[model samples]
Target: MLLTSRSLSRLGHWAAGLLTGLVAMAAHSAPLVMAIGDSTLFAPLQLAAQEGFFAAEGLEVQVIGCINGRRCLKHLTDGEAQVATVADTPMVFALHAGHRFDIIATFGSSSRDTALVARTDRGIAKPADLAGKRIGVVRGTSAHYFTNVFLLVNGVPRDSVNLVFIDPIRGAEPLLRGEVDAAGLYRPTGPQALEQLGAKGVQLPTLRPYTVMVNLVAQPGLSQDTLLRLLKAAQRGVALLNGQPGRAHELLGARWKLDARHAAAQLDGYEFRLSLDQTLLSTLEAESRWAVREGLVESRAVPDYLELMRVEPLRALDPRAMTIVK
Candidate 1:
């Protein structure tokens, strides 16, 4: 049917309005690149992405997987990712390197996450046995910090053992190839390494030396509104993790192809919660000192960790989550 000029004009306006709405939606959903470590420690973030929590928060998140937390933070520094999942150790190193970012929230933590998997054949039956032997560790990571603390706790001097810096992506390959007697690894890697070693490997019996704080870091200028939305989404993910742990594990195992037993063990070791607490400050301070003392980072005064944290976002999301005194 032929349309009147007035009708045609109305139709044009409707079409224009429809196009405008579509453009606004597209802009709103522009994907935010989140560089995340491929480890069980980041279960909350991973779950949030996989379970539609991010989308539910009206945030389009595109995750870039890195081999370790250090690399994940590196992506943030290099501008490849707007946000990253990193542990306290990497944050300390990144601070030392003058890379500025804000710790938005700590989503997970575990004392038993990092361990030394020693080859029985290398006479490394106990933690002390690591003395004078080669130990493989991922440099500039929680595994690296854990290795030092583990040795010190076991009465092994840092200089006594030969530290073989291995690639984070390689896990325990150096140990598997007999290049190192033991490998300091984080979960999934630690379990996989022990499994691969069969009866030939043993994890040293040492008290938990380090509690890695798995954190979400934002680029320096990330808006508080965006941060709050991200944290809110992660809070929902944390609720899923804590409330229905079995379902969370099932989802994680399916998405990451984790062994059922390994997934359960990994999940059990972690406590997923959203917080910006004093413990996080204490851990960052301790890690900073350790990094400098161990010559891991160049000698420099520790940056004010409180300054590095952006607590307002978490506070705005949930006041209880912001326990950081400052």
Candidate 2:
């Protein structure tokens, strides 16, 4: 959680100092970032703030939690935030719309980040059971891609099912009320669905090749110095998470509104290794193709994602983990 014991004093101090007009956020704070709100995809970045990882790097990050990637992108585009956190799927779509930015780091995964949940009584015991059924998802987003990919990988033709576009927040509600046969939901909404349906809810298997890549994006011309400091802090955050799973799980439970056991269980579903690897490249490429094919973008051409990746920060932080893309 970003409000952990180690982080309270700094945040509280900032809050308390606001009345004096001393919180010159733009002048005093290190660059600001708008991260997806309460989204599991950006946990590493949140952990970086909560565990004093950013402070250890001599950087003061004023983090704003936006509700989703689209909003985060807005913050970056409008110059309200120096950096933004979003998944690769939306990143590709935004790029197609001419959002000039560079990917600084890739973190998190979709191993269990997205799930195809079915109401047990719907008789969706197998992947093929979804044919001709209604599957709800928030259209043109990661959940949308997950829904199609889930069906395609499972040999359930995309056209065989009815895809109803619904907001992810209440996406599961329809399923619980027997409004939709199934839904493509992501945490923490997936857990909400499971809680509502109990034994009646089943999460479909995650498609490894289709895992979503969470990334940090910065508006053009961000300083190399600033980028490196932020990444060094993030790198430490990853180490802390790996070194202290017990404490990490406790934090996750608080942030995600899950029990300790549930938090631990959810922890296994993601890999928080921040890097700009072939995995990220391939995922972006695939998502671009899907976005274009689905008419989600105005341009049919998929930009060279490599050019969008800025590797200097990661290379400086750990050259051993950096690989030449071309």
Candidate 3:
């Protein structure tokens, strides 16, 4: 009787284990997530995907690379993607257009990662010098905003410079070939431009710390549970990227085929502040105010930017990790 009872107990334990496995498998079969972004955002997605971080969280992510923030917004608006990594300007535009989305989190925080590159022969050493010159910039992008602010604050009239719209990825080519006098490009591309054409670039000094370039946005009505899972996974990925940069660089280099020095330099200058910082909030407020005054958005209809931002997941994962303003 004792032996028979022990065998039955063992069988029951196996049955419970099987039940748990089934439940786990069912949870893992949830709908896949779609992510859209440019190269900067794409790198982390690729790393997360390659590292099984998403899968471990029971998420299947489909990452698509768009040319710029505008295209990223289009992808989200067109229902081509459910989530996107973009800049503050595009997010503001989407909010004004009445798109129901939330700024989930930010990856980069500084403008140092981006620069205004000019031909060495052009003798363009400062933001003011770009006046009256045709500068290639992706209109409606963070780069565009930076360029506008840099010029205006430096006493360069908005009308003094001719603005030309160009794809950020291909913007350098035109500038290198003398099609445009200067180009606004991110670090990776900026480094590539300097290496390829020996172009000189100037980093703009702005009131706010030039960090927080990329922000992760999600479509409205994402279930709280799902959003929490994604935030957790992303936080995990961010921790990896920040803590183990060499491994991060290795992964990025393998995918982008970037040289070690360029990749390291890009990583070094990038401020991947996972949590929303005071500087970012202040910058967003200032940018929004500027946008309203400059007729970018209706002042009366300006939504509470804080409402459009969701940081609960980050707070939930590690309460001490983020210092939310309010």
Candidate 4:
């Protein structure tokens, strides 16, 4: 049927409105680049990207996986990614190095993730046996800090053992090749090393002094709306992790090519959620002081960590999750 002039005008108006809406959506749908670490500690980031959570939130996210948090944060600092996944150690070291950035939120944390793995045949059946042994560590990362704290808590002096610097992604290699008697490792690497070593590899006992905080950091000057979208997507990823454990395990296992049992074991021990809290600030300050005392950084005084984080985005998302004072 031929349309009347009046109906044709109405159809034209409807088509114009549709075109305007599509243009606005296209403008806001710019691809967001996130440089994420390979550890399960940053599982939320991976889940968000892989499970279509970010896409569901009208975001096109590109994930660039790094060997460790330090390199992930480097991708952000070098202008490669708008967002990065990192732990407390790299942020402290970066701040001391004069690089400005913002911590949007901490997505996960765990006390049991970082541990010392040793070859039992090497007579290292216990933490005290670590003395004078060449210990492999990823220098300047959370594993390095945990190695020191593990030693101190086990009554071994810091300088007593030799620390063999190892690559972050290949943290367990030195111990696997017998280059170092023990290695302080985090997830994926830790579990993988133990599995490869079978009964010969043992995780030494410790007080578990440090809890690695997996954080989402943003490059300075990112728009708040974009940051909020990223956090919201991450929050959904955390929900999938907590709400659907079996699916999360399966998906993560498939992503990393681990068997179901290995994936479940590796993914255990973490509390995945989005928050900006006092404990994070305290952890940063402690790491900062440790860095200074160890001569890792030139700055003697601890920088005010509050300046390094922007809690408004997280607060806007969930007021209850914003527990950090000021």
Candidate 5:
């Protein structure tokens, strides 16, 4: 049927009103998240914001920098940030301290991300040689835990070594200057230190059980809608990272001042990812035990990990992708 002028005008008004409503929904529904992720090599949350992944998912994510998981947790607890990317070790401490958070997603299991780097010239040709040597480590971070576990597994006594607590970012210098016999460091700085140390540097083995899984967490009271948006954005961000690593690396280098090639190398070792499952919860429970023994936490009872995980957001997207919440 042919439309008359009056009907056509009515049709235009309806179209305009519908367009206005859609815009309003996108505006009001989009959650403004003050999200902090890895400050160094790890870059999922940063990539999402840079690549427009968050915007595509209708989320307004503000990326901030924190030195490590513990600092990220501090940002969340201090109300400086709404969401954060933290690892299991510090989370063990935070939880034991009575901070309530809902871990919405897990990033990945990475081995090259953290390690114990030693200077061969310090007469430390082996992990056991680390005994009586001064070691630079950042306390309450993954490297700190890795250092302790590495020493334990390698049969080095804690009392035999002198632990010098220093920031990971500043670790490479001290090792090069012979200020510390070795340094416990993670990617970027870790790799860079080894490169600078050349044949003089040695990478000791890492404890697989300590599986430092970087996770996205938020206050327990975070709205389900916002959590879902974060999940959507994170999934897309991981896809892009894997699908076109060159472009991702270039962007990361230009924006974050990281070397593209080094970033690519770093990315290979990490699983820029998303998950809320039994595998992750099981890991946390195991870490809790280790944490308590290491004096990282005082809780004799492992907080029921399931209570801290909010799986509905991830489940809503892909039930098969997430484990059944018990």
Candidate 6:
């Protein structure tokens, strides 16, 4: 029998209500995240995306490549990316410059792969031997900050060294061709530079007494639930990296053109974690103070270092959720 018009109207209403409910659930369920960082941090994102960890967390994440610290900070402040990796120095500077960002977690802290490389012919033996020599560096970057600190700590005057601004990727060429006596670069860029130019180099210690290599940061407005999901996902990714180095190496090689051996070596040097603990907090605060004293930040605008950190999400997650890298 044919349905009456009244029945059809009631059926339409039911369907509409069901559709609305479904849409609301989807909206509340999946959070969108934007990540920006150097090639190293980008490696895990590529792997995690392939492994579906973000999907498991009810998140839709967009990972973007940003090598420059200043540009990454600008993208984050302009709302182009919600979560990004920034060097500890630039994070401190951004805080003092009045941009609002929250540090979600610390991932990598090793500076072992970060080096001050020189052409063998340049006759540069140590940090102190570089006086009156031109050194190529990415100005206003972590490498640059570290280089400056290295000079000062080694009792080398700022004026005694000549700094040439250049892209870190292309820096080795200038050094190899005798354009500069030395170049400051971070791995795998540092490794690539040494391999390509067949140049001899010396690894430098952490420039600042307590400096972190990179940390995850988010915009100020993410909901607590969303933040928690993100931290859990990231922590899971770190665990995955530690347990499956071979797979992690393959992922890095495919996405970032990183050599498997080199990638594995780099990962081996780091102890990955999702914590922004007292050591990290204290280290960042001390570095920020050093920046202010060194004129990297305005003396009067120093924000509380703790204010820059947001660790509740990581703390809320079960400790069993993370894999501690040995």
Per-residue error (Å), model 5, residue 322 = 1.3
Please give, for residues 237-269, the per-residue lDDT of candidate 5 as tens digits.
777777888888888777667779866766666
Which structure among the candidates has the greatest TM-score?
Answer: 1
For each of the candidates, the C-alpha root-mean-square deviation to the true structure, in angstroms, is 5.8, 10.8, 8.4, 7.1, 8.4, 6.1
307, model 1: CA deviation in Å? 0.8
By TM-score, rank the candidates, best first.
1, 4, 2, 5, 3, 6
Best by lDDT: 4
Which one wins by lDDT: 1 or 4?
4
Per-model C-alpha lDDT, please? Answer: 0.87, 0.77, 0.70, 0.88, 0.77, 0.69
TM-score of 2: 0.84
As a whole number from 0 to 100, the lDDT of residue 216 in candidate 4 is 93
For residue 242, model 4's alpha carbon misses the true position, in angstroms, by 0.7
- For residue 30, model 3's alpha carbon misses the true position, in angstroms, by 5.9
Question: How do all models score by TM-score?
Answer: 0.89, 0.84, 0.81, 0.89, 0.83, 0.80
Q: Across residues 187-208, which tens digit of lDDT does each residue of candidate 6 receive?
A: 6676667776664655444345
lDDT of 2 by residue, 1-326 (tens): 45787689888887888955665554555555645445776777778878778777777677888766666776887778888888777787778888789889876676678888888799986778998899888765677788878887778887788888886556478888888989988777777798889889887664443577777888888788888988887777677667887887788778877777788777667888777788888878888888887777899888988988899988888877676564
- Tell how far residue 148 is off in model 2, in angstroms: 1.6
lDDT of 4 by residue, 1-326 (tens): 99999999999999999999999788567688899888888888888888898888877888899989999999998988989999989888888988888889999999988889999989989888888899998878998888878887789988889988898755677889999999999887887799899988998888656798989999888888888889999999899889988898889899889876777788778999999999999988988888898898987878888977898899999999988888
lDDT of 1 by residue, 250-294 (tens): 888887787665578777768888888999898888888888887
Model 1 compared with the native: what TM-score?
0.89
Pairs that collide, model 4: none
